[model samples]
Target chain A: NAGVTQTPKFHILKIGQSMTLQCTQDMNHNYMYWYRQDPGMGLKLIYYSVGAGITDKGEVPNGYNVSRSTTEDFPLRLELAAPSQTSVYFCASSDVDRGFPGYTFGSGTRLTVV
Target chain B: AQTVTQSQPEMSVQEAETVTLSCTYDTSESDYYLFWYKQPPSRQMILVIRQEAYKQQNATENRFSVNFQKAAKSFSLKISDSQLGDAAMYFCAYRSAFGPRDTGRRALTFGSGTRLQVQP
Candidate 1:
């Protein structure tokens, strides 16, 4: 079903470089999120979209931006990538009824900023 | 802010044995959700189990089950008949029931993962 798909499974960027991480979900869910995970740490929220045309900053929004122009696509932008930005990025989608069950996560994008 | 905690940084179990991972959370909201997500070397986040704060009965899936104690704010995952495929990093996460208006926009807070090593 391709529940959630993220592009550029792996990428290496130099300092100050800019790139976009693409995420799409075929489930037509209303919620989508971008998160970054560091080694031995939990996933940190980067940005999220409730639905098409509504985007909001998450816990860790610095140096990142996101847009939700369509129900299936939500892309994360990394601007001026820095060494601190090296981590694995994940995109997840979910429906509103998440009383306890609701999220489908992507495989993740591993980015290394050198 | 709601917070989740996983005290175990690492754990190991032999194949066919049972293992339990502990997680505790702090939240003021009475309605919330707790989850266990497994991430393998492939880095795909897989949902292991989930528990609703309002539900008194714990949730179970196959060999996976959760011990949910709402009064103590504790949730633990029990994996029975563990297999090599069960080896992975397990994370505990929290989400408020009063999430954003749109379901897709809610943010999840996660605890540091516990590395599970299943030996043959």
Candidate 2:
């Protein structure tokens, strides 16, 4: 099974551009999250959803947005992408009701903005 | 809010030897979970080991294990029989057991991370 799938493994954008990072999971998890990892740093939560139609801001949510329209998909949107937004983005999901083991993270999307 | 810290930025271990990466966290909640994740060059975040705050016994998976000191809020990962394949960046993460209804958010808080290099 494709646990968590993130599209556009690599991408480059210019300032003021916009893009969406896709994330899909087949595990039927209720909780999904978006995180950005800068070089030499750990991952920072950007946005998350406990279930469909319920999204919330995370630690770093200024330049990004997220929507969970269905159980299997949670996409991250970058609006007016700036150079400071350049970082590797990761998508993760977990089922909290099932005695949550750990998050299943996607391979991640490496993005660069100039 | 919980915060995790990994003091060691880099570490090395000889092949087949053992190495431990330290992680400390600050949290007011007593019921929480700790985890260690390995991210190789592929950037795949793989769960190494996990420990529930209530569980006094450490968690182990094959060659990976964790020393969870609940009172100290310290969780360290120990890799036994280290191999070249074990070379990767390791991260420590914390998650509160409090349901989203109580905390409004249940996402994990992660530490900076420690890069481990297995030497031959």
Instruction: Report residue A60 deviation for candidate 2 (angstroms).
Output: 0.4
| Docking level for model 1 | medium
Question: How high a TM-score does candidate 1 get?
Answer: 0.95
Candidate 2: segments with Cα more than 4 A from true spot: none
Candidate 1: tens digits of C-alpha lDDT, residues B23-115: 999998898888999999999888888888888999999999999999899999999999999999999999888754444326788999899
lDDT of 2 by residue, A1-114 (tens): 759999999999999999999999999988899999999999999999988999998999999989999999999999999999999999999875536556899999999999
DockQ of each: 0.69, 0.72
Candidate 2 share of real interface contacts = 0.78
Top model by lDDT, which number?
A: 2
Residue-level lDDT tens digits of model 2 in B1-120:
789999999999999999999999998888888989999999999988888998899999999888898888899999999999999999999988876365345788999999999989
> lDDT, candidate 1, residue A42?
95
After superposition, the stretches of candidate 1 with alpha carbons farther than 4 Å from their true spots are A97-100, B99-105
Model 1, position A96: C-alpha lDDT score:
58
